[model samples]
Target: MKPQSMLFTIYGEYVRHYGGEIWVGSLTRLMGEFGLSEQAVRAAISRMLKQGWLVSRKVGNRGYYAMSPRGQKRLDEAAARIYRQDSQVWNGTWCMVSYNIPEERRQLRDQLRKELSWMGFGMLSTSTWISPNDLADRVREITVTYEITDYVEIFNCQHLGWSHPGDLVEKCWNIDEMNQAYQEFIEIYRPQYEDILQKIQNGQEIPDNYCFVEKTKLVHEYRKFLFIDPDFPKELLPDVWLAADADQLFQDYYTLLNPCANRFFDSVYEPCPLVEANEVNS
Candidate 1:
């Protein structure tokens, strides 16, 4: 895994739980478990700081890092989606976003498109994006974040046209591709899950560090779906969706590994001190 991406996994899976902060030394040591050099970890941290995903503080001679508010918001959203169960019932309303950004602001337009995609919006046309979820508030946040409120408009409406909703869905996303990805995930991890379960049943002692590594890699792999899966509601999904199966497998594997993984993490984690507001500023 790339150092920066690994750091994000560590922060999201481990550091956020223990006061949402970690000493730079502790972070470097944890990164070493994944064969990342201290120099690489430091460089990744610097990049995250520059991108406003991380904030740094100093207490005496030691430096610590924590998620910035923006980062916290993003991670919180991701965690919710990552651990979410099967799709909820859809109300048959589609949230549509239409933008008319000027040619002069092509960069902002491109960024807006990326943001929309990341939020599970699929491009229906050149300037129109749609989702089955109610994302008006999220769209508002994106518009405000990108300073493109004047160029963007959001609507919650039903599709009453010639094409079926399923057809629209097919046009918007590659369901076959996503299903194959889930199948591959199942193929890769189901064996690992079965092996670990057999070992536990056989009274074999799995090392805490081993569990930690397994759990981290498991979550890291599962988290990839956030990029590719739009997580459409049950009403809009294909008849033979594999994402539900993948979700169940992930939950089972994660539950099996969580205790030992947390034990190993707690052994090495060094939480930041709770300083007074004024003291922190100083």
Candidate 2:
């Protein structure tokens, strides 16, 4: 895994639970389990800091890092989607965003598209995106963040269309491809989950560090769905969906590994002291 991506997984799965911050040394040590060099970890952290995803604080000579408000909001949203048990009930309304950003701000336009896609909006056209989810607040935030409010328009309306809603879904997204990916996930992890369950049933003692590694890897792999899975509402999904099955397996396997994993993590985790907000550096 790339150092930065792995760091995000670690932060989302581990560090966020323990006070939402970590010492740089502790970060490097935890990353060491994945064979990442300290230099690589530091460089990734630096890049994240520059990207406004991290804020730093200094206590004496030691430095600590935590997610900024933007980062925290993003991770919170991701966690909600990741652990959601049921598909949202669609109100038969689609949230559509249409934009005509200037060519001079091409970078902003690209970033907006990426953000929209990440939020489960599918591109209906080169300049228009749609999602079944109600995302007015999220869209507003993105437009403000990119300073493109004037170029963007948001609407919540029923699809009184010439084409069926399902056809629009197909046109905007590759549901078959996403379903196939979920099937692959189930095939790979089901056996591992069964093996571990059997081991537990036989009263076999698993190592704490081993559980930690397994849990982290499991979460890392499962969290990829956050990017690829738009998590469409149940009414919009196919009759047979493997994403739900995959989600259940992930939850079970994660629960099975959590205690030992947390124990191992606590052994290596070093907590940082809280400082006043103004005293911290961004």
Candidate 3:
């Protein structure tokens, strides 16, 4: 993971619990586990501050940073997608966005396409994108941001028994590719998991630094799915959906590693009023 993205990972996963703030000294120390230099970490912080994702506060001689309102909103929206357990009810409907941008505005068109994909909309055609979840708010945000509301249209739609959900899944996404990614995640993390299990079985203790690094890397790797997969409902997926298995493994190992990881975080900074290690089971 890039050192800059690691800033968000640390804040969203850990520091947010401690009043959504962190000191530069503490951040530099935590980032060392990933082999990031103190200078590099500070540079990333500077960039984040300039980008308006972070705000600084002074306490005596030291400065502490926290997410700006804009940054918090971005993280909150991402959390909704990343940590969501698939909804229990899909309602047999789809949300679609179709745009017909002028050829001369190719840059705007490309940007719109990227934003729609990030919002979990799968490309149904060159100009049409669809998702099982309601994306009205996200679509509105993109249209307003790009000033292209007039060129785009959003629809709430249903299949009407004409096309198969499974076939649509295949057409809109590369299930084979995603399954391979899931398999790779299993291969990489499963060994780390077995080592943890072996330590437990032998009544051996795990090092805090090891736990911290392993958990962070695992999260960074698994989060790649958010960009690659639309995470469609089960009814719209192939019978052997590996994402479910991957998610199960993530939850199981994440919980197993939590105490050690939390122990590491607690050691890096001063005690806080809030919980140091929030449980990830939810």
* lDDT (tens digit, per residue) of candidate 1 on 1-282: 998888889989999888898999999988888888999999999999999999998886789999999999888988989988656679899999999999999999999888888888888999999989898998899799889999999999999997889889999988898999999999999999999999999999999989998999999988888887878987888788899899999999999999999999998888877776555521
List model 2 lDDT by residue over 1-282, tens digit each: 888888888888888998889999988988888889999999999999999999998775688889889988888888888888676567899999999999999999999998998898988999999999899889998899888999999999889878788788989998888899899999999999999999999999999988988898998888888877788887788777799899999999999999999999999998976566556453
lDDT of 3 by residue, 1-282 (tens): 688899988887788777888878899999998999999999999999997899986655566888988788767877776687766667888998999999988899998988787777888899998888887887887798789988999998887765688888777878899999999999888888888988878999888888888887777787778777777876677877788888888888888888899889988975323333442211
Clashing pairs in model 1, backbone N/Cα/C closer than 3 A:
none
At residue 65, candidate 1 shows an lDDT of 93
Q: Identify the runs in model 1 with alpha carbons over 4 angstroms from their true place.
A: 274-282
TM-score for model 1?
A: 0.96
Runs with alpha carbons beyond 4 Å of true place in candidate 3:
102-108, 160-162, 270-282
Clashing residue pairs in candidate 2 are none
Model 3 has how many clashing residue pairs?
A: 0
lDDT comparing candidate 1 with the true structure: 0.90
**How much lDDT does each candidate structure score?**
0.90, 0.89, 0.82
Q: Highest lDDT: give the candidate number.
A: 1
